[model samples]
Target: MGAVSEPLIQWFELNRRLLPFRQEPSAYHIWVSEIMLQQTRVSAALPYYERFVAELPDPAALAACDPDKLRKLWQGLGYYSRVANMQKAAQIVCRQYGGQLPADYAALRALPGIGDYTAGAIASIAFGIPAPAVDGNVLRVFARLDNSSADITKPAAKREFTARVLEEMPKERPGPYNEALMELGALVCLPNGAPKCEVCPLAAQCKGRAAGRAEQLPVKTAKPEKTLVPVTAALITGPQGVLLQRRPSKGLLAGLWQPFAFEGTAMTQPELDAALRTIGLCVQWQAPLQSTRHVFTHRIWQISGFCGTAAGPAPEGCVWASRAELNGEYAVPSAFAGIMRQWRPE
Candidate 1:
């Protein structure tokens, strides 16, 4: 580490957030946090971290958690593959490693949820391996310091940064030194416009700063536009039961159960009734209950739902069940669940 790590560590000691993960942290806590922090910020990860740790607590506990229960814990956090893989990794820890996070970087990286970045973080932060956890923050630091015009998202850039940090790790107290470098990037190294060079420790060393190009050094490729998805739903009601439909095994709200619904251009009640009819249900007049929006990473849901009576027995399309099933048994999307909360389950 250069003259930067000493002061940065001092600054971090004085200014760090009093987060739950930082308190008496174990390897599991550190590992979980590293995973959660990937492509996410400390402020945003805070509440989710608290809820996750409180619910799972440890490797054994996490391994034992039901898949649905685990998904529920991560209901809103997209990129669900991360959470699902974390559970699989927990089981491995419990069974193979006796519930301890592996110390070797290679061994840890081999874990189900542990990627290269995550492995480096756990090995250095938790086990003191002098590894450099090159993430977006580290990449930004390198890009600005070197004034590299390369895309930070490229694999070669990440590998080069990681190797460089590993070589630069201080002989003594490497863990704090490495963590401080990352802290500087996340807290002070602004991603879009000019970084706060006045306060940055490496400001003098930054080539981008010297050239007055800190705002543009690390170039990024364009991001594609997000698409809009429209959906219609029925909150069908009769003596038999409310109509429930099982979502397909893939895409948004996969495997969840909800009322009869379809993706469409318009959310008109008659159109929704017709959609239900295709599945063999004839609908009676139903009053519209709510029109709302649910936003996902690449798609937006403009949903309108209504409550109505069925002509006779629930059509073959309907999963004959009471409201109890929707709330307890089905993993309804929170958007749907929100609507259900307002309904006085009759």
Candidate 2:
């Protein structure tokens, strides 16, 4: 065992939070939690996790679930592709692995959306396998422990840190050891230059602390600037309720429903009328609603919204939904929450 094994595990056992997944550390539970936690916080993912597991408990159930229903279940949690890939993997598991996730690391890695870090997490935490789950947390811990100034965003640095993590992994207690490192990073050796070294169990052996660079060890490359996209959304409502259009099946917010919108600079009343006319609707524009912005990984949407009343039937490729139906049936993406909130019945 490496110097981090004993004390780190002890600290984790005493301080780890009581999460639902930890309470029932089955392979399915661990797998679901890991996927949800990718871009979401623990607190934010808790209700979604509980509801998802209750609806689809096992791989077979997930494989058989409806795609739209799955999207509804995963609503409000962005990155719909994660759940989509999970369903794909579940189908394969049902077909090939008898509806159970494979315990082997390679087999887990073969599944869609299960990268090295996620694969290692499920294998080690759920199956007691000796694998290193090197996520951002573990990377920060490793960089601080060795006082190395490596850019964690680089593949070579990740490979080197993964090797170091494997060397320190205790074979007999790999699950606990791996969990301990992750927990330590989340709670004590935090990111963004806010690590709490004074309370850290491995503070004694942390080289970054000795060198007074714990906050600066795990360097990362700067991301490119986001492209700005200006959008105008029409919240057209009539006897049927609100008008919503299903987005394209492949791009940002893929396969999700949103208000009828177009990307361009702000439009005048005549331009907006012409645009609505092109879509087979003669809408009388009411009051302007609040403007909002939503940020994605590669782009930013600066949205201006309008409330209007339509005079005719639903437009082509669009549907009118009641507020109740919108709440229960349609899986609208959160990107349009600002506009949707201002919607009113005719």
Candidate 3:
């Protein structure tokens, strides 16, 4: 406690940008923003935050929002399950507790989508509890301050760092203290190999300073390589509308609509012809709309999007979702976010 200075607090007090979630911090807003910010940049998150807050202002409002609309809003943000779960959690709160976000940490954590990080954020920012909001940003700050070679990706190291910070959290201004710690990491103790210490408040206490490996203090294990995958998507269309398949209710892109894609391999021209014929109607196949390259953390897809016209009745087992049906009535994964821009309503 004695190690921190007026300079540190002052720097944050004057420099911290007033954020959307902080303006009138509430449990709901803090929880939503924290989940959105996970593995996402602040600049990328601001619009999503604003739109989400506007659309779902409170528990009841969120509870009432169609899950598809929620997912659509969250489209392109990635890690979409987090958003979906929040809505489910909100509905649960509404049902069990009358639309109010629970105040207790255990209760909050128990919500469908609320995790440890989100629970801490809401508890500290909205409730002013002494709980520390330890996130990757906070972890990086502590790792630099202690100047230790701890692998941050490990749970034990994360828990140890969080416990120490929780001990030091100033009870009176817990929000400020939390923000200060996170701010330090986001601005001064940057990741990806650069840190600006000339303006750092904790410059004197940084163990990395003495050790000369500040950028390397909070180490992490090497990332595994992404396996390459090949998938093909169809543009099966007729008067009944575009033929689409509903993804199985569970797994990647679960419950979303997709064209009948030839998964796992490029269609040999002959295979392509057979696939086109199998759809129950046939017409000339325009050249593929160009191969769509989509990347996921565990897998990379070299997907080819084909344009085809159908001359007969829509096939069985495939749903012909119309343009009206596609706008807000259905939920699709962000992987389609880019392709939708090229789609025409007609």
* Per-prediction TM-score: 0.83, 0.97, 0.89
Model 1 lDDT per residue over 1-346, tens place: 5565666678778766677766856788988888887757778888888999998989899999887777767665555667778988989888889888778988888988788778877788778887778877888887888888888777877777777776667757666766777788877887887588888877777788999889886786776677777777677767755666676756666665676666757667766767666767777764777777776677777777777777466554346666665545555666566555545545
Instruction: At residue 146, give the lDDT of candidate 1.
Output: 83
For model 2, residues 68-162, the per-residue Cα lDDT tens digits are 88999999999999999999999999999999999999999999999999999999999999988999999999999999988999999999999
Q: Stretches of candidate 3 above 4 Å error?
A: 5-7, 237-243, 276-283, 311-329, 337-346
TM-score of 3: 0.89
Residue 283 deviation, candidate 3, in Å?
A: 4.8
Worst 10 residues of 1 by lDDT: 337-346
| Tens-place lDDT digits, model 3, residues 140-166 | 888888886788899999998988787
Sort by TM-score, best first.
Answer: 2, 3, 1
lDDT agreement with native, every candidate: 0.74, 0.91, 0.76
Candidate with maximal lDDT: 2
- Top TM-score hit: 2
Location of the lowest summed lDDT over 10 successive residues in candidate 3: 336-345
Q: Sort the predicted structures by lDDT, highest score first.
A: 2, 3, 1
